[model samples]
Target: MAFLLLGFALVMVGASGIRPCNLAFGADQFNPNTKSGKRGINSFFNWYFFTLTFAVMVSLTAVVYVQSNVSWAIGLLIPAMIMLISCAFFFLGTNIYVKVKPEGSPLTSVVQVFVVAAKKRRLVLPEQPWLTLFNYMPPKSINSKRPYT
Candidate 1:
């Protein structure tokens, strides 16, 4: 009974941590999208998988096997500790990682999508040579279906 409850609690907490940390860790990679961001992204990918699997290995195998019993509270603490450490590392790495804007944030990707769409209406008005000044491709197949609408 105790073991089952412990497992359930761990599952809940572990899942919650995984979702946001996944984003936080993901953003940490491309902090600037430049040379430094490239290096940061590379390092984050290599280290992220290594630590993730290694932590999982220790939690499932070592925690259960080495701990030797489910009669005590220690079995549960392993995951709690994992959460603690994972979250701690998230904050610890924040200065190094790119920041993840919250969902619905103006900085989010959808904001730029709106900007692009709003601007597209004007893109078609310019003549071919003038449109070329912005490096935008003139819409092809103009006679086929008038895609701009």
Candidate 2:
């Protein structure tokens, strides 16, 4: 019972993480801004879904057939072996795959702004307006005429 509960939790976590990560990881393979890359992305997703559908059909039919007609252990072993092979292929291609670095979270900025405001609540403002308001100014790339919406 404990092992079953742990397996269920593991499956849930893996399901939540895998789909979004795989989609983003697959998308990272192509540059969507360019014509060729856009076409490549479209092609990739087209095949990806097709393969996914085919795999589902195969598992539903083939695995179930094997499990029913033959030994359940052998049927389970087939997929376990396939999963091992798939993992091996993924690791082999790791060097060629794009690795995206994590940028700091947006929430960090929001928290910093609140903390700064609270820390300065009792402080007197500087005599020069520019010195006091400098932190609130937009980046140099932003045009003064067009304030951020």
lDDT of 1 at 129: 70
**Each candidate's TM vs. the true structure?**
0.46, 0.68
Q: How much lDDT does each candidate structure score? A: 0.69, 0.83
Q: State the local distance difference test value for candidate 1.
A: 0.69
- Can you write out model 2's per-residue Cα lDDT over 1-149, one digit (the tens) per residue? 99999999999999997976787788778986899999989998999899889989989999999999998998999899999999999999999987766556757767878998999899887689787576676567434343211
Off by over 4 Å in 1: 1-17, 20-25, 69-71, 88-149
Q: Quick one: how many clashes does candidate 1 have?
A: 2
The candidate that wins on TM-score is 2
**Error at 149, model 2, angstroms:** 23
Who wins the lDDT comparison? 2
Report how far off residue 15 is in candidate 1 (Å): 2.3
Off by over 4 Å in 2: 106-149
Residue 41 of model 2 has an lDDT of 90
Give the per-residue lDDT digits (tens) of candidate 1, residues 84-123: 9978996887776544444445455567679879988666
